[model samples]
Target: MMIHKIFPSRKHALHSWNFVMFRFAMLSLLFMMIAAGCSQVERRDDQYSISQEPQRIVPVEMPPSSDIDIAPSESTLSPKKEPETEFGIRLTRADRYSVNSILEKVLEYGITHVQLGGELITTVDDLILNPEKKAFVEAISRRNQSMGIHTYIWSSELNLEGRTFHFNWTAPLVVARQSAYRSVLQAVPEIDGVVLNFENAFLKPWEAVIPAGLPPFSSRERIRFVIDMVRSVVVDEMGKRLLVYAGTGKEEYATWLTEILENYPEEKITVITHASLQGNEFLDVWHPHFRTVGLHRHLLECDLTASAFGGMRFFNCLTDDLYEIWSQSRLHDVKGMIGLVEGEDFSRLATPLQMNLFSLAKMVFQPDIPPDMIWNESIQRVFGLFPASNEGQSLQALLRNSFFWWRRAGMVKGIPLLSYRGDLPEHADLIQPLKLIDSDALHPGIRFLLDELENPRKQTLIDLAQETLETTTWFNRAIRELEHIASSLNPSDYEWLKQRFEQQRLLANVYYYIKQCYWGFRYWEKNKSEEEALILEAHLQRLQQIGEHLEQQINSTDEIFYAKRIRDFVADIRGHFPRVILGWRDRQWNYLSDIRIKQAGPESVELSWTSEQPSISRVFATTGFPIFEITKSAVETPTLEHRVILDGLKRGARYIFKVQCSTEDGKVTNSGEYLFQTMPAPLL
Candidate 1:
């Protein structure tokens, strides 16, 4: 008999709780939370006396108890079969009834590993406090192991004491890791190994973890040191494997990997990474890991969930981009893939995007088959459209255009700037920070476009507007073409796709308007005139209209395809109306941001600041007050970040400087004087 593990959903929670008595529920929950004892469970320990069973939603279609048996013993377990390319799926949800069905269906696609994903259990403390989860995982793990399937858990941190406790990095001793529970491995011993995410958005940097004085470890040293620590518990003592998820950002991941490989030549630990250089967006660039000596330790993953962009609640598709990763994988000596079915917040379990989920899984077994054929087969089965028919081809075009437009929608001038994950902005606050989160500056390319917008040195307004408009236009075109030919397709799928695509297609307008508004604001800000203000407000009003439409859809379907996030994104745009466009118009202005002194020397000082809008800025300084004498301009180039060098200064002298910034459309503002002191003369 096979066991089933399911994620609890909102719909099932109501009935599942009805069966549990209040007293028993509280007692059982306490037992699970204490399964990882506060002081007892340590490195390499697998002691489990926990029988804290929460009320699991029993599968409706599950076979009767009389027909099932316990897991197969080790002696009777099936032999492992090694395929050319091994595959795995990362699952966060386990619905009561259909999870068994979902598992049974995916296993047929040749997955050798089942990663009970990171989102299923987050921090070390989270797992420590939730033993029911570990119990559920262990139950599934035993059955998976009997059939030669490997199980792994991706954990964000190793702090066992909880989110409050920080590791004693001040002491470079192994004793510092004392009292820390290897919670996941200790709680669920049946798992093959554990994964550690060392960087990316979730990391607690040295600034946060370390008190004061101690600087954060370098990327290379941090990874190697942490790997050694984890290896002791996972690999050395427990005799299991260790996988270090070095994180997904392109430069950060490459930097860490480069440092680790260069310093430690024979690192035996496996690294799990993704091919999408940006968040959930796949491009044709070469994967950084493939550039290294040993590709076998690198496991390439692609997010089939599209969690960062949005859930498949909309017509979000990764079919082509995912296939591109498969094509790249064949070129490398890579380890098996681990497909993450859920990310951060969103999932694609029961959605229409399950076709993408199954198709990517089959890639391990049928690497030679094209993604198109698999997609077409899924379309035929679900929509009842024959692969050779005109409606089927039109559907294909719709999917392609849908993905392309979505890809462009999240970007501003080619950088992944705007993102939505379900009902929320992927990042916390989208409108307030003109700069990227945690980043002191925007991408240089985005700055370049800001330059063109403010200065109009290159790419006219018409050209700039065309960037997002083309994508919006073609996506709309594809949707219209499909609607005309899809009369023979299944009504339910048509309704589902219509809801998803209409919202997404509707958002393509928001994308267009976002760029158009940027253009409109720049045109207006150059003059701050009545003519320009009306044009700018009109653009803003267009955005407000779309936001209302999104609210209507969300209200009608109770967020059928999850337009709430996009709605919030449009609201963010409306919010900018007051803070950005209106504020700019109604203020006495100096448009500098992120202003700082780069280098202070006896002979010269290098200063830099980013203008709110692109501009050529000149710095005027004097040893005296009020009157400005000497002047040095930022480089002839105009950009958001501008710089000037105040040279010909005496040692130990104090200089007061002010800036005058000039936009290309002929507007200028004089800044208040700011002061900086030159370094004292060095002794001879």
Candidate 2:
């Protein structure tokens, strides 16, 4: 039956506001059908599932060895790091200028160390010429001093310019580069100390400036350079102190650190490492490779004693896993611990500000509370799945998993259509501006054609959307559970919970729109009929309307923190539907099929494909691995026959290849990943 005839009773109502509700009802029915037929989507350990239980609170044990010869508090500064005052936070130069904000956080959290990251200079001239920069440094220094917080300047070996530096690593340097070390020290005399943030260079492959196919400078050279740099700073420049915060798991680097401590006076240097202590107390640890107990033993083996190693500190980075932070602080002879407070670390999570606030309050001020006791209290702080209202045996497990899922879908990372890179396609119909669809424009002729096309992959997308909707539905249920039991929360706690609740609601809306768009795409792709276009167009309008209403409601919300995120979410959602429509109209939808190897020669292969629509095809090939792992990016060619000759394959070796097609209009599609083996070497 034609769509118009199928909904003949509501044909006249299409122009009314009720049209949106009608479309939503139809879309929901479609989702119900697909969801009921689709098998359950596999759930990650962190995802919401009916069978999973909340994580349990596990007590952290002290290190095996007790002989970490920590020094007594020497002066008002206390050389040995402790909780509250010992916690440090690193900020960008932008954050450093936000003095009031920094001070507020410091005062609230009792933070004693503030590390400032900014432009790295190599020469005394570079430092002296930038008076504004020097003034900013001096200002931070004085402010931190008044607040009883020590401020350190943070710099990495691989400077921003993508050049190898002598002071950075053990690379051979001209006299000019040799003087860079003293220049940095002399330029920042007002600062308490400087932190050399040396880590494995392999982690930032993009930042490497070495020759093609060559790796970045190794951490071993960096460690050696640091040791010599510290010696020169103290001996030649008579630099009083320096801080080294290295997050290296390599044993060689740890051994090198041991040598630095044994050689240098403990009072002159402070070594800080990433503590990554957050989440569950049982499984989580500061170091990625081992537990806190194992880390302690490693340090002991390295002879990182209070008297031997001097000032040693550990910090939580990337996550605000406060439960373990409390435990780490109580470790014997451990100098100090720092916590991440700004940028990606904070922006990535829902309720980050509040979580950090609570973490700081408990860790700093409530030092008397035992770490394990605090862990127990914190486990119950966040909402759990299946409260008294739902079936649940484990509160901790629920809290842990909920936080995990919340992080996954909490924010709009990238807008689908508005965030396209490079130039947009010039398809006339695809690029047309969005407008409300007229019922008369519906064409049933293309619907029949669409019904004839077979696309299992398209059906798979619908299945995934169904699964995602199920996940979001459960998330919404958990949010409602929190809302129900939040009466006992204080005003501030309630506000935080409400903010999270609002974000969860926004996330659900995003998932719903995504499912709707997927269905619309399938509908349009199948038929491309006037009726199908109108149907898709109406769905687009419905999505925009939802975004508008959501924005209006959120804007009406008084005094909301992170309000901009919700506003951005609304914009992304509204902008996404039109992009998807353009993709369909422009034939950017990837449907490369009938791929087969025409020739598999000794060193090369010829491949061909037929797609649903004509497109500019590009092929990418890699050997024995994913194409993405290769250094050479994908090559593009507008294929007339949808064929390409791939050269440089080794005989008897396996290769993976994939194709991508984009229309002249802005739409794009990717082919399924393919793999094949070349014939063996020919007998000589």
Task: Judging by lDDT against the true structure, name the best candidate.
Answer: 1
Best by TM-score: 1
lDDT of 1 by residue, 604-674 (tens): 88887767667888888877543457888786666788878877887755566766677788666555344
- Candidate 1 residues lying further than 4 Å off, grouped into runs, are 1-84, 93-101, 158-187, 200-219, 250-253, 262-267, 277-286, 293-295, 343-352, 422-447, 453-461, 549-684
lDDT of 1 at 611: 70
Estimated TM-score for each candidate = 0.64, 0.44
Angstrom error of the Cα, residue 247, model 2: value is: 5.3
Clashing pairs in 1: 6-94, 7-94, 7-95
Worst 10 residues of 2 by lDDT: 1-10
Error of 1 at 350 (Å): 9.0
TM-score of 2: 0.44
How far does residue 60 in candidate 2 sit from its true spot (Å)? Answer: 47
